[model samples]
Target: MSVRLRLAALGVAAATAAAGLALVTAPAAVALDNGLARTPQMGFNNWNATHCSGDFNETMVKGIADLFVSSGLKAAGYQYVNLDDCWALPARDAGGNLVPDPVRFPDGIKAVADYVHAKGLKFGLYSSAGTKTCNTAGFPGGLGHEKQDAALWASWGVDYLKYDNCNNQGVDAVQRYTAMRDALAATGRPILYSLCEWGQNQPWNWATSVGNSWRTTGDINDTYAKMLSIFKANIKLGQYAGPGHWNDPDMLEVGNGGMTDTEYRSHFSLWSIMASPLLIGSDIRKATPATMAILTNKDVIAVDQDPLGVQGTELSNANGLHVISKPLAGGDRAVALFNENGTPATISTTAAAVGLPKALGYQLNDLWSHKTTETAGKISATVPAHGTAMFRVHAGGAWWSNPPAVHTSADLPLPYPGAPALVQPGTTTTLTTTTTNDGVLPGLLGEVKLTGPAGWTVKATSPTFHPVLPAGRDVSTKWSVSTPADTPPGSYPLHVSTTYYPGKSTSDYDLTVSVAAPLTAGTTGLGDDPWLSADNGYGPVERNTSNGESKAGDGHPITLGGVTYAKGLGVNAPSTITYYPAGHCSAVTATVGLDDEKTGAGSVTFEIWADGNKVADTGLIKRGDPAQSLHADVTGAGLLRLIVTDGGDGNTNDHADWANAQITC
Candidate 1:
């Protein structure tokens, strides 16, 4: 049996977690009282930014401590200032004690600890449970010298120990980590014990009393893919995180410059809701406004540090969209609407959907936007690709989980079929939005306004306000929206704002301002003015390129069977794209294969459906082989679907490509 399943045999709670794994908890008699990291330790680690670089010296460490206070990070609960690997020399001293690198820390480890302590910040050091550390420098680890190393760290006033797993020489992971845990306990010091075991041995199943926080995934890089992967790995283990012992999904990559601000905000939101340790991994000294704003989002941080010790659980994960709910201390719910898709889409969940009790009106606080709005009951947002919309939802209050946000959708009976109705330049269309009062109480609906690009005319045709909106009802507000005469032929952003309580509460929705295609029908298939009704995947699918690692990054050319194509769609595995054909097309053709990128490490299957009927399929294509050609008949099909699956294996590098995809009438 897997280690996760074995938790029941180890006197752990037999109840299962949302991930369907056995929820493990240590016996009350054995709960470790390290008196540290009661609510997922918040701090900074130098590994992500410095990584043993020349600049990661005493001066840098001191600068971080100084900035921590001046930058208001300490006030926001970022206390510990920790150092990662490579602080020590490759060899120990004559007495077999680990020696600080003279060039890096001239005054020894204690001096740096003292300096940090002077600033009212705790200090941490890094080591491994094996003979050698993980880095190539091969610094000596504390494998056989657990007690001795623990004493030395305690003597230096080290407040935390991030003990990694490397070069274990085949020792059982539990035994190896437990040895260091006992040693730290023996020191009679209150230093926090962190297990950087990388979840290889299912630390969540057994590390409750062993370490304060254990790494549940591999190292995190400054990329959306890595962050999302780490989140997926750690989100399921929420049942294990509590006051003292928590799950560590590596460290934060906030100011690392690899991802967009939107993605960084999503990362921070996910980490916070999961109750993971909030360790700032970037160099705060060089942090920008965007990075700092994301790092110190106080409302979101409050959710992370909620004294209840309850981690967020996934309410729903469907079609690359996720809704997570974390129960706060005082009956508040921190709801996260996360979109893992490549395109912007609306993600939402009602208060009732998140298990909140019935209330008159729910006040919604947008944690990222920092806007206070009220929802009759619905909670949602137009979450961007790789973005998250966090809301502190409660009935109404000043405590941790208070408020509900609004949920808005386009009214049915659209003028044109399919999503994102195409409209001509300079033309006016009647737009109707459904203003919902899903709350249990009556609501006062005020001015409903629609704002769009400059020069676009958007005026409400119907009454802007319905003084009293009853519970579980919707008000359809119609607006005459007109585009500029010279409007561009691309998707635009339009926001529809509705005030429920005049100046006090409001709700908003981001509407996709779709316009006419620049070219109605090009030689390429998708250029034929076909509207995309649905597209969802693990990662965003790119146009005319192979799938990227994450986000809508510039992907590699569509190469299949060693041939590069100029026109096609690049998609990750488990992807589906439904195209609304503008006119009758006899058939669709394409060369399907795994993209040559990823160094030939992918397995995928491409399938096509016409009018809900499976028309063509390239079953099970692996890497390093020629492309498979596909031709699907769709004589009278109004919709065509392009799908990619992970070939019955987990989607690791499944970058599937549709090469030279075209349609023939």
Candidate 2:
């Protein structure tokens, strides 16, 4: 929940208190009390994944609704099944009324809406408040036909309306949108109104009473960078969103292919904590299990739907690390430990940093991992690159300061990059988990179990059953864990849980088990799709292209010093990427320079690190400078790190490229 300020468009009229142009200064801002959107709206929107494509049709809309119930989205509290642009025909009928696309909705719009209503779901559609819809195809808009279009939509049982900002014809944004808002209200039917002004006029400053939710930023694509950018802009606008009115930061892009699974989880976690609208932009009918898992996580979704209607805030965002805190009902706090770096990091913060009251013991419920553990006061996690560690923290009321101490830990020799075999695949390790009754009251211990993935054998080597653990006492259990012979060599996560008496109070622990595998050896190797970790200054790090713009897949070919390289990383300054050479690589080399796209306005320094040691440096490489050759000796190094630092000045136009990066193995 890092706060960010965005660029502005022209024709924006500055607001002043003397001009009577009201601005939101506090949570006292009032919303249209239509008794709708008591929480941020949730459901599906066919925009990001489908866009203005031909595949968007009545069958697709119906299929989404059918999948909502069958796929558990409905049971997960998704109420609206909405459709975005391209749903209307190019022209209206003879009655001067908007027309549903005849080919797409052959059965008519009402029939499709009626079908959705019949399935116990609400319906929504899209249009614009201007002369034409956003589609360049020139579909009719609701500019001069507000009342007529609103009446038509109410007749079709449309439950929501997303009024966009295109073709406004130089009209004042407030005037134009307010016209549609009044038109929809006068229709005598309740329709949740969403203002999609793209924050051009600073909608959050004045749109509370205008609609149920107002788009506070531009459209969102499915990329880690884009999602992160939107969260930055919206998280600070929490004072503007409430029960009846919300600030829309576009829609969800969970299942889209642009980002990794870990990034998608962070995206979902941020949106849920921010209380943003959860409009799934992916095609649910074709969603993968990983995608479905992210969209249907009820524990996280509960934070978004928490009746408190309080949006989360950014407690801190420093040096690519971020912490977000959302207050939930019943004195619970939803905390997010987000790592924006391209390297794995242990983000640590005290409970007080997250606005939690002092307590003897606190329960940290891992929303993503679904593990509950007790903590004395600290909240920390070793988060992966572009990953988030989310927890629901609650103060333990009756538990003593020390609480019931349950520690599930295992120790094995750490593996070296190329040292003799250590903890190789198909090996057995001993796991020792201990539990102690440090609480004031005596407690009876329940079953203590250690669980791993399929094909992994786990046997209790020591006694696990402890009927009663009196005060100031402890018990220990050891389990023999073996990896499957066919198991692929990589890091694996294992879980163990132990419960105690009285309320069946539970404590769960997570541990990582690494199995050493041979490293892949190569020359002229590059960091591409399968990056171990990454963090950038502006947008995503592109492959084989200059860091061109703020969107993924929007980069030019890798050009530097008037020469082009086929393999390298295109990144902005203030970036870091970690690669696992696993001691197979002896040297790391690259041709580095500022991308030609910057002309002569950017400056940066590129450096290479081996196992936490700086090995190569390109100091103050500016635009139009000759490409510099960087070679780092990474002998016996487990990790090779590439870094791009802004040259003293801020990171403006600082797009640097590593051309023809290679590893000598």
Candidate 3:
């Protein structure tokens, strides 16, 4: 059988097992009937901004609860306040019951839940299905104490539970989560169960009956790339969502400072269209006016809360231009046009192409601008870079109806070569672009021009030419591009435009030239390596800092002999980095270290391989350890590999760095 089929079968088997577990006491019935969250749940979760910080306490939760009522959020449809990880004490009490941290929550969790309930909002708490939570404090989890914990939470009037996945002792996901589901049902309380497994086990396949909502991706940071990736991944999983269950792409980072206001609107619109649970990850107390406007838009929220409960589908996605259409109740549709590219372009489409009937006209209303227009055939707009235009289309057309003028007779195709072109610093490269006339018309003439960054020099060979570009004909142009010696490593935008004769029709093509850092011989810093890639890893390599481990003194420099190396690569746990020699190199040597300058608390085993063969292995470096020197013979070898792994213990502060790496021919 195919892998996908096998996975689906496993999901069905897991669901059957969960049903069997639920039927142990009584006949098998439907999953917990929590009348809450009939639509995607709207709430506030604390993790993105304040991660395991000591400030997450009773006072803070009450303050946020007060803000929800005073700031009009409760009336605007947000009703839950969730306290993420680190809410409990490090150990259980003498009676083996989970205890709230006295210092953080002096009034106890029951009092806090009462405060939220008094405000007409629900209370939620965080816990893992394993032996320990994700926090470094090692708080008690709900692995063996599911029945006691569920009963305790139900007694405390808990309305929601965010069950995380950490330290799960190799137990199957279905069994662990099903045990919790059965336990929660036994309590007979209507609590929303959210499975925060980070989408590792494709929870959507089996989590429909197991959880009210399941995270479809890993945690999201406040960046355009991260938000866009989550949206793209969640839009394809619509088949598994319904009224009681939803696909969660983690919390919303809309009001965060990493992205601009325009980008945030696109983020909100896409999330609403995908029918994702809109869990606000920002501090609502200090939300700016612009942020408030985007969050409280009634038109967008209505589409998300529509009774249909059908998630949106992608209509067209090409060249960073996307169109997502969500079917709403009352025969209306919510559409979003997204420009994920860095450069502006004119994107056009028709309503019929987006699953709307072409013969029947519709009225388009822009959700952000609150403007309405009538169209019969096509709608076109010039979208800004990294922005979106959202609209709601009704089935009937009205006054001031004007469709885009249809163009026939001629078509122009402008295609650029080597998209996202890569080059080394201080190097010269050649860029070729082609323009063609794929139409029946005879007379077509145009000129192509290239524009790039300020410090770089770009000159085209032809620059100015009036060619007799006819039907099904093409022409190519070349440009000599060069960057300065001190050019920084980043993606630089390059715009190419063509203007034709007669109609003076213009077309644009956007290109990004990536300048890579150069790696040479003699004392090359590992962090400064030109090419760095990771498998089963995240984020970029850092200079003098650990990537995932945020412990103090874990980001200090590495010292060997008299030279102190401050730049290197830091990984989470089991990750490998393969280095490709820039030029001809026979051997490479480096000093590897664990943790920071002061001391190393975690152990990491380092291995070096050359051309698929193991060259060296440093057994295991323990805490408070110095640097270890290792060398690998790379004679005629195309690649050199460096592997670091957690040494028996869990991946806490497993920071491994290679210092003062160099290549010798």
Candidate 4:
């Protein structure tokens, strides 16, 4: 049978088994009605938003859950107040019971659950499939205590459990998580189980039977690359996620630092289109108006929560720039055009590219614009630099009262905003134009028309369309303004126009676009390299840092190089190697350094061996080095050791070293 079919059968068997057990008891017990009522779980997480320092307690949780309801978040389809790491004490009670840190959560889990329940919100906690939980420093390991801990959580009223995998042993991640599934099932509580193994084993196929959602990638930081990387990886797992099970790409970074408003909107829109779990990881208490709009965009959220449950799939991509399309339940489709490029890039997707009819007549609602429009033929929109444009396309005349309203800037273009500057000659450039769209109808699409002087000829044009700009919307399309090779240096006027189509009407802007000298290489500080400023190579996995051991109900005690890193950025590595001193492994060394300096490119490598023979290997990593946060599975028996080295361009001192590594599996 096909792998997909096999996995589906596995899910049926697992669920059926669990159901049978329940029937033998009460006969009425069943999988809790925990399907995400909406597309995205529009809610807040304590980590990115409040951080661990917020000292989230019963009062704090109640307040946040209440805010979710009072502020129309609940009405906007936001649910779940996920409590990230650091809420448990360092040890379990004498009865081997896990206890919340009194100072952080004075009222205990039950009280906090009550408060969240009162606010019409669900509560979620974090754990790991390994011997230690992600918050092991405070809580205990679920490794041997899966059954007890799960039952304990159910007793405390947790409606959702975010099970992460830290200090886990090997590729047996599927089995590790299955243990918890059995445990949680035994508790007789229907909790929304979310697998957080960072996509190590392609959890999409194995986790459906165990969790409501499984993380398809690593933990997400507030940076654009971090978010983009996670999203890009999910393209291959698209077909595996559905209504009850999803491929979580990690929590939303909305309202978090390290990204601009435009970037955050792109983040939200893309996540919505992916049909991934929407657990907000940013603070909600101090959310800005723009952030609020992104968090509660009904149109975008609709795409995520579409009843069709078919996760979005990547259609096309290049140089980090990509396009993903998802079909909606109402015989329509939602398409997200993304430009992950450091410099602006143009991207387009006609209905036909994604298996839809070209003449279906489309409704282009700028997710960021929160408005709608209709197109008879092809509809296109340009993605801005490191930005995204998400649209809800439906059969024209299907969901319209009186063609959607359209408008460009009611205000005229402010006097020519000076001449345009070329950041990359014959490649790309940034152009600015004023419009009166003011976020009305389906925003405006900016376009530039250029004319060359006497001898100078217009070269290939580089276009960047802002996704639902500050007050205007840009149409999605490709630009072609070829420049004459080695053309004479001369001044040129590029005509700029901003077009708008409201409902069934279309408008265009006419203005001057002057060209300036091309920008020198690297002068713009922004170029084609998206990995700029990224770590040059892999580093060592700091033992006790990203690796730990613990028992469920017994707070995890991670001895990081003799110290404890129980807070922010805590310590993460792609993988951790523990030494047990046996078999071929006589000695081990963990080293992280730079590589490819001679070629100006680099990579991170985690090398493992036994008696001079390579035993395990982790490939190149472009994200960061020191081997931090690398996810993989290995094969072998005997001593497990490691050495992390940098293969990317840079200095040798950039390497990280570890003398001993261990494997509990």
Backbone clash total, candidate 3? 0
How many clashes in each structure? 9, 1, 0, 69
Error in Å for residue 390 of model 1: 3.5
For model 4, how does the per-residue alpha-carbon lDDT over 105-170 read when each residue is reduced to its tens digit? 887888888888877778888777776666525356677788889989999988878787887766
Candidate topping TM-score: 1
Q: Rate the local accuracy (lDDT) of all candidates.
A: 0.77, 0.77, 0.70, 0.55
- Candidate 3 C-alpha error for residue 186, in Å: 1.9
- Return the candidate ranking by lDDT, descending: 1, 2, 3, 4
Model 2 TM-score is: 0.70
For this target, which candidate reaches the highest lDDT against the unseen true structure? 1
Candidate 3 regions off by >4 Å? Answer: 1-32, 399-665
Q: Return the clash pairs for model 3, or none.
A: none
| TM-scores vs. true structure, each candidate | 0.76, 0.70, 0.65, 0.63
Candidate 4 ranges beyond 4 A from true positions: 1-42, 135-138, 169-171, 358-360, 398-592, 595-665
By TM-score, how accurate is candidate 4?
0.63
Candidate 2 lDDT over 1-665, as tens digits, reads: 00111111111233213111122223444568678999899988888878888899999999999999998999999989888888887888999998888899999999999999999999999999899988889888899999899999999999999999889898888778878888989988889999999887888766776789989776676656557767777887876677888888889889877788889999999899988889998988888999999999999999999988878878788767888887777868888989765444556666676767777777777898786655666677656657898989887764343334343333333332211112445778776766655444566765678888888888998887788866555677888888877786566766777777656766655555556553466675674524455667666888888886567789988888778787899997667776666677798888998887776477889999876678889888777789999988999887667888877554667888888888777
Task: Indicate whether candidate 1 or candidate 4 has the larger TM-score.
Answer: 1
Residues 1-665, model 1: lDDT tens digits: 23442353245444544222123343232345778877889999999898989989999999999999999999999999999999999998899999999999999889999999999999999999999999998999989999999999999999999999988998888788888988999989899999999888888777776788899876776766657767887887776778888889989999988777888999999999998899999999999999999998899999999988877888789777899888777777889999876455667788777767776577887897787766666886766667899988877453223322445554323322223344568888887877666555556645577787888888888887778766666677888888888986667767877776534466666666556533234345652235454343444668788877555756888877678888888887667776655455677888888887877467888898875578898878887768888988877665577878777544667888888888765
For model 4, state the Cα shift of residue 640 in Å: 42
Better of 1 and 2 by lDDT: 1
- What local lDDT does model 2 show for residue 89? 78
TM-score of 1: 0.76
